[model samples]
Target chain A: MKKVLIAGASLTKVGDHWNKSLLDLAVEAGSAALKDAGIAIPDQIVVGNMFSGFSSLQENLGAIIADSLMLQGTPALKVESSGASGAMACNVADSIIRSGQANSVLVIGVEKMRDMEPNDAVHAASLGESASFTQFFGISQTAMCALLTHLYMQEFEISRDELSVFPVIAHKNAVPAEHAQFRKAITITDVSRSMPVSDPLRLLDCAPVGDGAAAVVLCSENGQTKNAEAEISASAASTDSLNFFQRDDMFDFTATRRALAKALAFAGLSIKDIDFAEINDSYSSVAALSVEALGFSKRGEGVRDAKEGKFDLNGKIPISTFGGLKGRGNPIGATGVYQIVEAYRQLTGTAGANQVKNAKTGLLHNMGGIDSSAAVHILRRVG
Target chain B: MSIAYWRERNRYYRILGSKCKECSAEFFPPVYKCRKCNSEKLAEQEMPKEGKVMAYTLSRDIITGFEDQEPMIIGLIELQNGVKMVAQIADASADQLAVGDKVKAVFRRVSVNGEAGQIFYGYKFVKIDK
Candidate 1:
């Protein structure tokens, strides 16, 4: 099998880009990434997005973005797996390269969230859930996660303060991250007392809605491998029940656990071998469950371990190296690509203050819905 | 939204779901195939109306069409038939709800699409007095 290498990566600062359209953000990041890769045009282009049609009233994103980038003739398309869209794009690009079909591929993940009203945005986000079952009842995704958090707390006897630690750590790391949305550091007390969006999930506990774009240039192993900062060692994805309540164990994220295990096995590594991880921290409870699913902590002990600083930058296995979804701002479809870009920065020694010292191998976990679909990628620095 | 809600009127009105004839396993929201046995032989069965709150949340940030219904209590209820589901907890305050509180499903208005649009109705749970 031909090895796939991440030739270059770029990201726009994640926030409410009211002035810029979705196409503008994609062009900015895509052009920068292409420039970074020293390639004028790639063999193919893949766009990862969730709700442009619903939020921006724009569809046919693939050709639109391709034409905007001045690569009109390129074979381009969009991949939508809700929040994991970005990572799924990368996974498809990897397959294209490995299949000996395309030597180079440009993967772009972008989301336009702030353009819609808050309630509308919430409705758009809920499109990822089971529309007939979950959304028809007027329950938002946050409400589902809140119920999950409540169950987790009840089952494990975890305190609100302990769960608050995840967001605090995210904000702390975001303080030094330039492209992060909320760079201001927050404390556990602030998270605990923050106005509740859904009971047990305070405002700070959830990833803020924002607009952003991230792009990565991938090429088959050859000349690109010489300059590549990280090699795509492994890529895998898995799925579970669309509705969270249908699962036998509500707290168990079987998709994430399965994806991680498969990706790690492909890379011939264990969870302990992971230097850092970019787990999906869409919600504080989601973060805890993800950590536990990845085997970083014992079952029902993810929050406890997080409170003990096990997931800090210098802890046993650091996570959310670049503020994660919480502080970095979750641009939905763009978030998975953001994780990959951040990993590239860390491996290439460009992550400045947020860099984990001597970090070599990193795991990127991106999920859609409530861990309904998960994409796990393992990247190792290959100088 | 109205059409979709209308399609599932039976499920919403009477808690109708699918039960696997092969294994006798039941599910809410209906499944095409049995999850446990992977059998396509399934039948429409009405789910139990009463259940206990496995988990609950009072959500202030709701989706569109639910703007007027802020701070809504939503619960994960486990029915007596051993099927769990998400439903809005109605006529109950935060102080009145707990993890183990028994509740029964009642048909209620879910949301009003627009000023003069269709009023969608669904099952909402209310705390059952001991």
Candidate 2:
């Protein structure tokens, strides 16, 4: 397989894009990426979207993006893996380049969730749940996560203050997030006092409904790989049961653990080797639990570490420096690629305000379909 | 809804599921497709209403329709049949919840979707008497 590199990347500020269509955002980011790489539109394009049925009621993303860009018949393909659709798109593009199927591939992940009411968007998002088990019972994703948070607290002797720190830190760091969806800084008290969505998950702890898009360019390393800034070192994905009922460990993210472990092993590194990380923090407690499952902190110790300022910008190990899904906003399909783009920015010293000091190595973790699918990648600065 | 489960809705509709007759893989809402073996053979099996709390959380802030309820408890329970599912925690404050505690499902108000103008109702779990 050929070595692949991220040649160029771009993104629209994640928030309510009421005036923008999916194609509009995709074209904007796609053009910006090409400009960044100093290249014209390539021979092929790959568009990744999670909820096309709800976003535009149109499933033909490839043709839509290509038509919008006026590059009809450019051999476009659409890919989806629930919310991780973007990252999965990246994996597909990388594989295509590495396998000699394409010289260059343009990947765009976009979602227009604000087009519908918040509840409808959430209901569409929860479509990933098993229709047989979860849908019949009507389980909200927040409630599902809240149940796990409650169990995690019980198993770890954790307190609300500990769990509250995650959202606090996420909001605090969002100050540097110029275009983040929710830029207001919050405190642990704010999180605790925020209105509850599901039990134990205050409104402040959850990511707001958002709309945006992110893009990246990939090519083989040999023939003019679009001026690489960072190398796609390793990407790994794993799956668990779609229904939460079949899992053994309610608090432990089995899929994340396996995916991260495999990715790190492939990269010949460990959590300590990572200078910074961008995790899927759809909820603050979920962020804490993700770090715990990644073995950054022992089980039940994540909240404690969080409470003690361990994940702050200047802390020993900072996470979600972009405010994460909590303060940055969760834009469904674009989230995973957004996280990767953030890591790329930090490693390249292009992240103006939120750049981690001397960040040579970074990691990105994104899960889709209620922990049923997870993807992890270790990125390195390659100049 | 099963005719039997619907008749028992006032108390709490605890739907039971069984494994595919050919594959032996269990499902919660009961299904025709055996996820494991893809066998098109299965049977309906009612789950024991009694179970232990597996995990839970206390939500503080409201989204849209739930603006009044500041904090609500949600939990997942493990039944004797080995099925796990999420339900709202009733008859107990957020402070009283803990993992592994015994609980049972009951009919309760679920949520307001903001469109239907109807109060969606479903089974929620309550702490069992010690």
For each prediction in turn, the share of the native Cα contacts (below 8 Å between chains A and B) that it retains comes to: 0.85, 0.47
Report the lDDT tens digits of candidate 2 across residue range B1-130.
3454445443345455667888666666566587678888887666677788877766542334554454556677777766676666788986787777999877676555566665656677788888
Stretches > 4 Å off in candidate 1: A223-226
TM-score of each: 0.98, 0.85
Candidate 1 local lDDT, A1-383, one digit each (tens): 89899998999999989899999999999999999998887899999999999988888888999899899999999999999999999999989998988988999999999999999898888899988777887789999999888878988999988889999989988999999999999999999999989989999999999999999999987636347778899999999999877788878999999999899998899887889999999999999999999999899999889988899988888899889999999999999999999999988899999989898999999999999999999999996
Q: Is the docking of candidate 1 incorrect, acceptable, medium or high quality?
A: high
TM-score of chain B of each: 0.96, 0.73
Query: Model 2 over residues A216-312: C-alpha lDDT tens digits?
Result: 8776766343568787788888888776556666667888899998989888897889888888787777887789877788877887888777888
Number of backbone collisions per candidate: 0, 23
**Ten residues in a row with the worst lDDT in model 1 chain A?**
A221-230
Residue-level error in angstroms, candidate 2, position B95: 9.2
lDDT, residue A125, candidate 2? 76
DockQ measured for candidate 2:
0.34
